[model samples]
Target: MDLHARLKTYLQNNPEAVGKVVDYNAGTDRLFPLDLTAANTELTTAIIADTQAFSNWVSDKLRANNCRYGIGGYMEHRTIYAVSSHFDTEDEPRRLHLGIDIWSDAGTPVYAPLAGKVHSFQDNNNQGDYGPAIILQHDLNGLALYSLYGHLSRQSLDGLSVGMSVHKNQQIATLGNNQENGQWPPHLHFQLMFDMEGNYGDYPGVCKYSEKEKYRKNIPDPGLLLGF
Candidate 1:
């Protein structure tokens, strides 16, 4: 079987082996499905330009809906990329998000969904970047897979080393604030990869719209493990 099919089958066969990435109670806490695309008429260019305003808008929406977390953005073509030139390229802009963003408080704890070892990690502190990112390597039976956690607190990298063993459901890091989290709203960018493409410490969480097919094979929907 191919990597994508193998991953889905593995997760489907061992649901209990996977753990939560963030704290959430289906019986109490609610989740707001956020939309950052142009279809979201409420998100204006002004709000997108101002980090604080953009954060406020997200919080306000969650509050209005009585939700504790705002979630979505797998393969979402967002217009919000206009806020940064970091996503721009010579031919096409990279507005296609390959990860699922979990919007919550800055200090929110993040946990590993499965047993893995730290493949690589670093603080990619470029503006509109991942800030602090970590990539973990795992083996599904004999198939190698990877998971990436981006926009994390810098403290998350403290004392961390390559090849460090991480237990399933272990607290790996916490969400970062705007000051250190690439100047965006506090959120965890979680993604799964079958291949890193020789990338270490960082990988492209957003790709050019035209390259969607190429990425689709390497990066699969995180919800497979997130269980959304």
Candidate 2:
């Protein structure tokens, strides 16, 4: 099915799964505007200065509480230059982020948003990669779709099987830290995939700027399901 059709199908089938929200990159009110331009000036001083330490501190807090809080906003901009070089294909520049990153602490409890079976998972261990991950298949009102939870702790997949059953809000896994997870700050990379296209335990979370149209057609905005 087409991207829009797949989204409509998911919404129509799984009303309960919709409207659940998670924030991205939460922090105290003191860190408002996290303006990039202003931050550039201070970049020369230290690598682990304010911004780096701040992300680290936030990760620790979120992981300890097993919760996340940030502005649950959508990707308003189309041309994202982030993580482009990570891909092997020359089209990396066209790739866009197909997921909504819930920037929270490591070890936070990641619950199943809806009842589903464990479709697949993997430990995509690499820099800027999804560490241990889980993909759940939800069949709501006969509309089948998948949700991916990335950057999870290794223990999260301890007893998981391909067809393992997971109920809504069930504690499935905890957020992972950079040590075991992909070598990056702590965060949950949540994405929705309509067609697996024969890929398992790994999929394209990032795409190039030039391939936005094609990806947008294949991967709908995740906020449609996350409800933010």
Clashing pairs in 1: none
- Local distance difference test, candidate 1: 0.93
lDDT of 2: 0.64
Q: Write the per-residue lDDT of candidate 2 for residues 1-228, one digit (tens) a residue.
A: 755786687677658665343332334321111112223453232332334564665545545555544322233332322432455564444234567776666776777777889999999887667889999888766666788888889988798899999887688888887777775556677887767778788777776657667666656667676543
Name the TM-score of candidate 2: 0.73
Give the worst 10-residue stretch by lDDT in candidate 2: 29-38
Off by over 4 Å in 2: 1-6, 9-14, 17-54, 57-68, 71-85, 88-95
lDDT of 1 by residue, 70-172 (tens): 9999999999998899999998999999999999989899999999899999999988999999999998788898999999999999999999999999999
Q: Which structure among the candidates has the greatest TM-score?
A: 1
TM-score of 1: 0.98
lDDT, model 2, position 192: 77
